[model samples]
Target: MCLQSDLVDADVDPAVIEATRSALHQQLEDAELIHQPDEAHLQTAKERSEQLNFAISSLRRQLDAQTRDVVAPRFDAIADTSPRVASLKASIDAITQLRESWARVHTINADIRSLKSERRRINKDIKEKSEQLKARQSLLGDLSTEFGRLLTSWNLPWVDTAVIDRDTFLPAVNGQPFESLQASGGGITTSVNLACSLTLLKFGLDHADVLVPSLLVIDSPRKAFGNNDSDRQRASEIYSRFRTLADAYGERLQLIIADNDPPPVTSDSFGKVEFDYDNPMVPGVSHPGPDHVSRLEETADE
Candidate 1:
């Protein structure tokens, strides 16, 4: 029932208003997360790996120089003591290579340890965040249940996705978290997918709450897409699924997405409204509001 460019008034339904507020708050939360990416856990692992590499390189260089210094002084002595010199040279070379190789192996082992530590930390952080999300989602669920109870008293379909602790059920692979829907599938990639789906579902559930705002806006959800065509396509598909989820809410949530590039079009579900880049609301742009017009004219005469 809303137009694309319409400024939503403050008189919207409580559920719609709460949805809008949650969506906007969630967007801000996500933005803050991007600005402060949780690299602390990864940094320890990365630094350990780097230090190990540096130590290995430094030891190898030292060993190589020492070997050369040892061999260089024995060049003339080689004729008289050729067999000894040759044997010594072989021993030095073998030991140097072995030591260097061992150093590298040690570094690799250290790297594995660092990675395991990082993974543990990452999992802990993810678990904590998942718990927080569940906490918020539980509040939504209570609201949904209350709404359903009210509807039941009047006899109507619940229409809210009753999802709780769905994220905890997802299987994590490597550092990436994902859910295992199939016998052969489950990884970080899958966890991210599950997260996105849960986000979409949460968006809907929040919309059904009578205390939420009616607006759901995303600045650019696909900004993470790199130059890879397949990745871009995948991003588009994820976005499509998001829109589909929004539509499934069926008048419960009103979505508004703004981006520099046009989002992939679907059949009759979403529409675009382009604003002039010169507009003040679009950022780095000037606006000639009514109050500015006469002031500028008066200044010109002066």
Candidate 2:
């Protein structure tokens, strides 16, 4: 009976020890779940603490740079200075309008240069045109001489000779001013006009550089405008002179004389193309005759 009781006591002691160990293990697990940090959380908190320390160190270094040991009292003098005269001790991030304004100034200067160049070009053109005009007008003296010779040949009355006035480019009779020819009626006037026309013709034929074509067309020189029966001899003389020119220049000069009842001048140098009421310029058209005008005048007088 004593041995059985001792074995039972040994078994009870082992059960109490096991209960105490289980209770201590359960307390330790509860404390760990409530307050102890995990491995990943501890690593993240360490990295955050290191970043904060580095930021503090950087701030302290920046503060040291602004301390009295580095910055001098001379910087305080800028406080009383004007904005225009003040200078900065430290570089600052900035943008200003001066660079853009300078660019605009350059653009305006380029435009001015271009305008000056164009003005020079225009001045050159004006000078060249003026020179060309002066050159073309250099033959005025020779033209005046030819005009006087033609007036003498055509028998201008009451004048020893006539000259072309430089200012008006018209005839000046016997050293008279413009329009000073003492002539009445159409007789002397017609002679003067014929002489002027022939003078121009001769001048143009002589001067190839002049702006005159090598062509002339004289239409109806006898019927109405100044060529009467009294001036028939003079008109015939002019036609003979034309015949002489047509023979001299040949094909180089083209002289077309269209007179229905032509003056008494005939030559192989002048080709004849006659047109009457039958064979007209157009097939079914004809001009009203000079007699038609005279008849109308008679009716008006009535």
Candidate 3:
């Protein structure tokens, strides 16, 4: 029922609309339509709340005394004697932490034992390998000495010194590579290769341990000779050396020689086979014309 002008003329802190709200409140207060709580009821509620608190305290005291007198001693005795009584959250957490630590220690101990066993096995293998290496080195040293002696005995005119490399086991002549002495054509190559083969054969024959063929085959000792008298003599000397080796080794060594022409051999201890255009090394081969008959006859006479 407030007039619009009255609403406009009202002075308020929050808003001008509060003028109606204040007037309605004053009318309600004057008419006693708004409630006013009784202090007597509030005082009765406070007294009841205090009585409930005291009653609860007395009950809690009785419970604590009963637990301390009866159940506490039994719990303590069980805790002291039986580990299973520790069912608390803190005890379980502590035990779990200790178990994790002990498991880690056990894992580390197992790894250490494995590593120690591996170390011992590795040490034993290394020791055996070292001994084998020493024995091999000694064998190579003897082989080198034997190779040097053979170069001199084989009529190697160009070579002053010869040796077998211990590491690679290749032949070296005059403190250099094998090719350095073979500039005299395939003859030198032939002799050096021949000497190496024979030396290994002799080594195998002498030592029952050095595994090599007791039998050897020579294609041609004088096949590369260029009409030089010294080359012929060298070839003859090679045959002589072969004879001596055969005599010395006896039944332990076998030598098979094949050649179109070889210098005169002083020894006749070996079997001989003659082959020409008529009879070749391989079967079912055609022969040459009659013009080669004289040459083949001359070779047979030689």
Candidate 4:
């Protein structure tokens, strides 16, 4: 029967083949499970650790070689480029600083021009205002006509005074002769002198657009009269006429007239400060008065 089965082995049962295969695998598993390790098996963990160390050492060598051969030379090349980069940065910063300075200069120049323009505008405004003031001042002349007429009628001979230099022309008034003569002369008559002086003073006051610093000093105004009662009365009348004119422009003008002596002047318009050198407060000859003390003392001692 065994010989007949060998001849038909190719036509075997599935369960029988599977059982045979499973039995062989189970024997292999059992044999592998029961086998004792060699010395090489015990050194497996050490061997793996040594292999890892060697790989790490080889990697370190490769890194060293790369650093020395490639990376170090490249680093030196990069270091060589740093100075030029720094110089370029410094140049760019300088250019930026210069540009800022130029911009500041332009701004200051603009401010100066604007200030000049404003100054010109202010000057023009002041000029216009000054012209307006001058125009307003010109209008005051029209009002002086009535004032002059009224002052003349009030016996004010100040307005009737005449001022004649070498070039002045005189016209005859009330059939009186027109007298034109040099300033320094005994040849000039008293009436002509009085008329000329009175007219000149009046015209000057009337035409004055602005005040001039001047003194109206009439020294010995009473000299126009002679040393008699009738002549003195005429002089008083003429002086009264002059005083009326002085009164008219009292606040705006000043008149200082002197005579040989003082009288009780009646005008309430002007102030009078009296001083008589001839009359002394003290009676003694050595001390005549405060003014004559020096002369009188010398004479008294002699």
Instruction: Give the best candidate by lDDT.
Output: 3
TM-score result, candidate 4: 0.32
lDDT for model 3 comes to 0.78
lDDT for model 4 comes to: 0.59
Q: Rate the local accuracy (lDDT) of all candidates.
A: 0.59, 0.71, 0.78, 0.59
Distance from true location, Cα of 292 in model 2, Å: 17
lDDT of 2 by residue, 1-302 (tens): 76554555545777778999999999999878755667568888999899999999998888878775645544554444545353331212122455577789899999999999999999999899888767655677677787777667755446596878878887777777546553542545555665666677777888877666777777665543455653676677778888888888788788877776755888888777777666766445565776655666888999
Q: Mark the 10 consecutive residues where model 3 has the least summed lDDT.
A: 3-12
Where is model 1 poorest over a 10-residue stretch in terms of lDDT?
154-163
- Please name the candidate that would achieve the greatest TM-score relative to the true structure: 3
Q: Candidate 4 lDDT, tens digit per residue, 25-132? A: 999988776653544575896899999999999999999987897888888888997988999999999999999999999999999999999999999999998887
Residue pairs of candidate 4 with colliding backbone atoms: 159-202, 160-198, 160-199, 161-198, 161-199, 161-200, 162-198, 162-199, 162-200, 163-200
Q: Give the Cα error of residue 147 in candidate 4, in Å.
A: 17
- List pairs with backbone clashes in candidate 2: none
Give the CA lDDT, 0 to 100, for residue 238 in model 3: 79
User: Candidate 4: where is the Cα deviation over 4 Å?
Assistant: 1-191, 209-214, 263-265, 278-302
Summarize candidate 1's per-residue lDDT along 1-302 as a digit string, tens digits.
36566665765688988999999999999988875655765787799999999999999999989988787767756666988878999999999999999999999999999999999999999999999888867765654443333222321122122222334633233223333323333232332443433354454465554344545566555554454676566556656655765677766666776666777656467766667744436455556677666666888899
User: How would you order the candidates by TM-score, starting with the best?
Assistant: 3, 2, 4, 1
Backbone steric clashes in candidate 4, count: 10
Give the higher-TM-score candidate: 1 or 2: 2
